[model samples]
Target: MFLNTWSLWEKEPDYNSYLGLAENLDEKGYAVSFGDNPFDDDKVGEKVYMHILNRADKYVHIITPYLILDDGLLMALKYFAERGIDTKLILPGIPDKKAVYALAETYFRTLLNSGVEIYLYTPGFVHAKVFVSDDKKAVVGTINLDYRSLYHHFESGTYLYGAKCITDIEADYQATLSKCEKVTYESIKKEKAFVKLRGRFMRLIAPLL
Candidate 1:
């Protein structure tokens, strides 16, 4: 006999607010690891989706407060979308850092045009970095879809397979949809010039964020 344990990572400081996984576990499911790989660039962002999300036949879901997609991850998303994968994003409508939000906004048009569905969480900032695909797999941890998180920060996430919490993540996603505003090309274009300019400036300095 073996003891099963699961370690989950979160960007939030609240101990009580981590993902709810109790009702979703079973004998076959086990713990996903936690901690950092300090020596390497954050390859978790690239690999998580490359292996898990790319294989989804239903949908690829993401929930994060801030977003800044690099070339490789962006290309991977486009590739997945082109193959008919429903790649959807849920981001913060109210971000803690305006500069990061501005930077994230600059890429809205490109992503929307490339067929990625973007949603803004309307009630508050959503700092959770979670990814779920086809309700079969999930990655929950500290990884973010930005240059700093993917290339600089020492981050990690737990990769789960055949876990019942995959559905819980999706259910959370659906609940979030009710509080979200969808992004469109026209909406991106409609943003004020000053805001757009700020986004461009933020983009230049994004690697430092």
Candidate 2:
């Protein structure tokens, strides 16, 4: 990760500084993998997410601030949910970016119809970017479930397999879930017409968000 950051630095590049820091950290026993974009490839983060989702057997719970998915991810998620895997997503109720939130809302109906559960944090905005599945795998990082983060930004995340921290991550997800309001088909039907229209318009330029 440090090497990736150092390589990304264009002005006053200092490779030795990052190398020095990297040399001090000792390897551990936990099965952890790092995924970053641009440095490795634009799809590094997306591949990590897809790999986890495809391997999940029991459940997959995700918390993301934004939700602008491409065809591949959209299909993968829908397939899992349709197969009766416990698929759930937590999104922000109080949006930090209204336009982006509207765009995200455009996906609700499709996902809901596919049996993917949706929750909105009612107390405030949910900025967390986390994916925990099957109590054995989890990812904690800066990558949002949006096109900008997946394909355009320099994002990174740690993929944890059989790590003890997976329990704590799932625990936090449950605690946060208690504060969220589950979204239902009825709720989507009740959404304001103007909001729906705005979301539809936002989809046209989602890649730039």
TM-score of 1: 0.82
All candidates: TM-score: 0.82, 0.84
Q: What is the lDDT of candidate 2?
A: 0.82
Error of 2 at 71 (Å): 0.7
Per-residue lDDT over 1-209 for candidate 1, one digit per residue giving the tens place of the 0 to 100 score: 11232332332123223365544544544345544554664365556556665567888998877788777777878778778889999999888988789889987777777788999988989988888888878888888888767777777677776667778988988898889999987778788999889989988887777
**Candidate 1 Cα errors over 4 Å, as ranges:** 1-26
Backbone clashes in model 2, listed as residue pairs: none
Q: What lDDT, from 0 to 1, does candidate 1 have? A: 0.75
lDDT (CA) for every model shown? 0.75, 0.82
